[model samples]
Target: MQIILGRLDTHLGRPRQAQQRLRAAYDGGQPPAEYWAAVGARLGIAVDDPLAERLTAADIAGWLHPDPAALDLLDELRSAPVQLALLSNAPAVFGRAAERQDWTRGFQHLLFSGDVQLIKPDPRIYRLLLDRIGARAAECLFFDDRPDNVRAAQECGMRAELWRGAPAARSGLRERGAITP
Candidate 1:
């Protein structure tokens, strides 16, 4: 990702601003084309530049992948007496790609920051998640790898926990009586 950003920065003749704008544009719910177009407008380049297309393709391709262990855990939870949802601070391009993955099927709801223009650590995003899932904040168990995101969930009245990994998540779920022994 850094490499792609660096390349984009070089292409735009901006040290870091191009990358920042691209990220902000995506995080703000702009589509890939729109994102590139915005960057092109700033740099006075044609939006159809092959370089932008390549960069966009590379960015989407490198976005994310499903963790096998996490998928296994999700499989275990499928039959448990709990609802599953995914709240991710990712671009809309990645969100669209993720929806096509089999692993994402287990989730009842998938909320991406780019899709909603609401990133983590923002209390409104948590509220939006609760609303979308049709649950109160206290009824949800939120897990995030970032401390600030977890803290935000906690502030929103959710039982938020820092995600250590699949093993720790399983243990935490068991401890919370959210899963079987």
Candidate 2:
């Protein structure tokens, strides 16, 4: 069964530049490599520098990390009567980084926008998660840091919350009755 869970980045650290550049590129329907190359240029790095060639493949540590408070909350939620999932708008590199973290196996599924080429606020991706998990729309509760993504999930018939922080996330889950108040 699909269980209610919050977003990954809201509780984790990420490479600011890479994350921003990637999301913007994907949203703009442009390739991430091109975005990074341009970003490098802005930083005085030549577009043809080898750094530009491997920018996207940089180690996850070079980009994001797990937030301690968020991880603590996640640990608490792990015992709740709900399955967990990581819904992130990141490239495949982020997924690889997650694999090295202690919380990697905590989630039942890891959904990345790059994997499916469909970002949040796009109903099709939400439907894809539901279909892959064999859960009905109403059976899932999703949390996202972005209001648009949360609203999209609501439109897809799932209860959703805009995850602000640990306390906020806890309160949201409690309100949904996913956890005790």
Winner by TM-score:
1
lDDT string for model 2 (62-90, tens) is: 55667778887888788888888887777
- The digit string of per-residue lDDT tens for model 1 on 1-181 reads 3444554557756567656657666776877777877766665665665666676777767765667788889998998999999999888878888898888898999999998888888899889989999999989999999898899999999999999999999999999888897
By summed lDDT, the worst window of 10 consecutive residues in model 1 runs over 1-10
RMSD of each: 4.0, 9.1
All candidates' TM-scores? 0.79, 0.74
lDDT of the candidates, in the order given: 0.82, 0.69
Instruction: After superposing candidate 2 on the true structure, give the runs of residues whose Cα lies further than 4 Å from its correct spot.
Output: 1-22, 26-32, 41-45, 57-59
Model 2 scores a TM of 0.74
